[model samples]
Target: MNKNFIIKKNREGKKEDVPKKIFFKTNLFYKEKGFLKFFIYSPIVKEYAFYTLFPNGLNLFIYDKNTYNKYTYLRADWVKSIDKMFFHIKGNIIIMSHKGVSLKTEEIFWDRRKKKIFNKKYTKIIFHSKKMILYAINGIEASEDLKKIRLKNINGTFPVK
Candidate 1:
């Protein structure tokens, strides 16, 4: 399989007929495990400074190396009201993927309230369906524990590879 993929999002809808340069300029930094070098050559840069990606479409997470603050994982499209104005996590998911990707996957989001930066406890907004709230909580615990173990191993000078 070719380890390369790119897509351009725009307000004018899909620009399927235009040249790729007119939209996005993508570079493949690592073709093996899907590391990417993405650059926007379009007009979106004139507006918002953030973008989101689904975990299935994820290359590398911007979350802290030792925390469960992957805001990207919490924005699945199936859920409702996941974003807010004062501060919220919102991103566009890959609704339709060519490969075996889930349309319900969420885009990554990390919106910090003005106070979040200076707050006593820096926190990220987590939204979930009433039924899935427990699942989300369990995920957080498991991720925190796993991160601790991974961090301990690395601290022991274990090989990263």
Candidate 2:
């Protein structure tokens, strides 16, 4: 797996090996067998990413990044209809989806492990090629493609200074 496709926490502040550009989104979240599973959709790159976050580690599976467009066109159902898209990041050959999903590397190494639903506060989130960040507090999903630009409420894009 490519390190650039992962963002993990270590002894240091944080380790995010991402590409120069990114597009990401996460619609469904659940826990299973000591791993957090995420179903993500990327409108820009038109790719679907499945993430499995283990205690202190991250695993990502992108469904045909190079040739997803063709597949999506053939199988529209592959891109599940999302009522609420938390966040999907993709760019520079990497994509990430976060739906109230947050965890530290040390948390994965806990002696006692448990499974629970995600409890983040935010709603809609979408990243565009490290150029813009989009999110909503009231929890809203996009009905159409969004443009990358600075917004008043949404935080700036990733790789911030």
Candidate 3:
């Protein structure tokens, strides 16, 4: 058998590779207690035994807990769900908030439980309201809503009012 196969025991006591489930142009929505929490759209998605992979690209939209309004938007060239509460996002990652704040990075890790996104890579943050741009060489930690942010080794420019 090929090494890439996910071997499993068949009914006949024979080893077989577990079939992978794949979908194209997929849209998934999550809800909690009848309230819509978030939505995920992917050009292509693959389901393995332990993880879900988005090979092409994915867009995520999170909704406000109370108002049910759009809170944040995330886009990435590739994404992998490490588990139920954590995801690995990579390749031209962009996160935006409804409040006109945006963040750009090559990679990041998102924690659903904490509602946080973090990375130890080059990152750029733009605040449209303040007309400022910030760059972080060492990386950044921020809330999903882009309200609270922490940047490491930061240098940036702000327009003087």
Candidate 4:
């Protein structure tokens, strides 16, 4: 039996189109300049003609180049990659950095080549060190590590230190 091709009948009892590829319990690692940059794990992945889908969600760990230590982590309930560099992520998106910053949103677009993440939906950012919570009403743009961030139309309370 071919793992990629699974026979499934539709409501009319006709066979559906099988995915080009399917991966189960897979880990993908990306390296840059002989240094580990990203590690992605997904329980299931399906590849079609135009895109790859992570239906069961995925965890992405980003490592520092010099130290090779994980500096950021991202999780999403659903992800679709149209190409190698660009990804559309949605459903309970959470991003955390080792610098004590966390971001929560419903959807986001990630550009791996540019090392940028952005969204046009509501976003909540928390600074653990400052004990402050920020809300972005219009959207947010930030680096992958959440180091340099820009929030638009924001209104939130900051604890006075």
Judging by TM-score against the true structure, name the best candidate.
3
User: What's the TM-score of every candidate structure?
Assistant: 0.19, 0.21, 0.85, 0.84
Ranking by TM-score: 3, 4, 2, 1
Over 57-97, each residue of candidate 3 has an lDDT whose tens digit, in order, gives 89998888755665789999999886668899999998998
Minimum summed lDDT over a 10-residue window in model 1 is located at: 148-157
What shift in Å separates residue 119 of candidate 3 from its native position after superposition? 0.9
Specify the highest-lDDT model's number. 4
C-alpha local distance difference test of each model: 0.23, 0.28, 0.88, 0.89
Give Cα distance to truth, residue 9, candidate 3, Å.
17
Give the alpha carbon lDDT tens digit for every residue of 50-120 in model 2. Answer: 32221111233322233322211111112221222322221111123222211111111111122111222
Instruction: Output the lDDT of residue 112, model 4.
Output: 81
Cα error, candidate 4, residue 131 (Å): 1.3
Query: Cα deviation of 37 in candidate 4 (Å)?
Result: 1.4
Model 1: lDDT of residue 80: 16
Model 2: lDDT to the true structure: 0.28
For model 2 the local lDDT of residue 111 reads 11
> How well does candidate 2 score on lDDT at residue 132?
44
